[model samples]
Target: MRWEDIKRYQVIEALLLWEGKLNARQLMDYFETSRPTAQKYISEYKQLNPTGFEFVSQQRAHIANDDFTPQFIDLEFSSYHALFNTQGEHAVTSLVETLPQVHRNISPQLVRPILQAIRYQLRLDIGYISLSSPEFEDRIIQPHSLVFDGTRYHVRAFCEKNQDYRDFVLSRFSGEFAFEGEATFDEAHDTLWQTDVTLVVCPDHRLTELQKKVIAHDYQMTEQKLELKTRAALLKYLLQHLRLDIYQAAAEQQQIVIDPECRKLLAPYIN
Candidate 1:
């Protein structure tokens, strides 16, 4: 076997030892390897000791020894599961449908380690591709949590380079990921946490199904008006892409309404 393959083998072994024993679907995310590759690895590992491996088909989980069943931490699966594991299904299928197309790019392999890191607060050495740059940069980032906006998966990590917390879009990254060490941040995205947006929704638009859903889930609505309480940066992104028709005294106007705070922040875009 090649050195990289041997490392992959070792990594799988270590992960199984730590996780007790994971199912084929679980292994695909844990190792970022294909189902066939995971199966081959399992078969090879089982071959070494014929009596060591056991399968519980009903539970859809595996056990290393005949007497032991693996225990799992309760967790929620996101879009990454659908992208990587073909057999797996998401619980929130309706919510998934309303989301933007960017979320479909989430890779299952990218989700698990980051989740594990946040759970344990581990620092990771990753070859990350930044959104603004064409080159891949190697950096050690302290991962906190995964944020799922309607359209994409973001890894919120304390970037050593920026000396601040930043979000990395998972699908754009390509390379080996390594757990370097442990680190902590006083707050993740301090500026973002402090920022808020106020969305003044006109009464006529309040009855739309999409408006009702967005209001219910994302904002607080009061008497035909909604105020979106969210980060300013996020609101700016929404404003830039928003498609809506405006009516001023029966004259139809086509424009997207941005929060006042967002409009000032996005003044450069104003013409």
Candidate 2:
């Protein structure tokens, strides 16, 4: 199937799972397709997964089966939010009216060269602004991969200026960038990016028993602890996101604490 068809089918599947029932008209409006095309997709999807949905003649809609299981769409919080936050008839009012978002202007001009450099194994000369430096400076970097840490986009690259592998935030990149011949380093050589680190998180020991229970349940912790593995380079960001970096903070403030062993492993990365 075409990529577009697959995406539309995934949307249909998500709608059925999230809203319980969906009709051809809704699909037509969402995909901006003809009624017949929308109906055809629904029919094709139903035929592909016979037991997933049932046709309701009275409602003229396809309702999810009792034992319906999602295949194309991941039933994750982010996926659900993306599916419902679209600008269309199927858009849903978010439960949280005001959500925090990182404000950064990322230009396609800056991103395109970085992506091309990574794809074609090339180097790039870029102007970047960092927290330590107020002015943008020229830097030669061997681009590797792009990472999204929820709030912003980061390009993991080998910085010639720093003589090390580092993350350059996309938004902080200034001016135009150009390909500067073949790259000296790839993703394989990025030690931090290549290495995996496990983070064991538990409710702050300072919290009361009841508070600990609530924190455990909130994090869906098993046995009062949650273990998550991520790239070593991303450990600091993940810790900061979960408020685990400030171990000395009060239980009500930090809520969770990292295991001492895990903390020791993450020491180099943690600020």
Candidate that would win on TM-score: 2
Cα lDDT for residue 63, candidate 1: 60
| Worst 10-residue lDDT window, candidate 2 | 87-96
On the 0 to 100 scale, the lDDT of residue 266 in model 2 is: 76
Q: What C-alpha lDDT values do all the predictions have?
A: 0.56, 0.83
Candidate 2's residue-wise lDDT over 31-73, tens digit each? 7779999889988888778899998899888899988887788
Q: In model 2, what are the clashing residue pairs, if there are any?
A: none
Clashes of 2: 0
Instruction: List where candidate 1 sits over 4 angstroms from the true fold.
Output: 1-103, 186-189, 194-197, 203-224, 237-256, 259-271
1-271 per-residue lDDT for model 1 (tens digits): 5765554444344334444565666556655679998787777656554564577887676666634321221122332234334323432122234333443455668666767778887888877776578788787888776666645667767888899877788776664588877776624455664466554543333246655455445434455355555564454334433432223442123222444564466454333
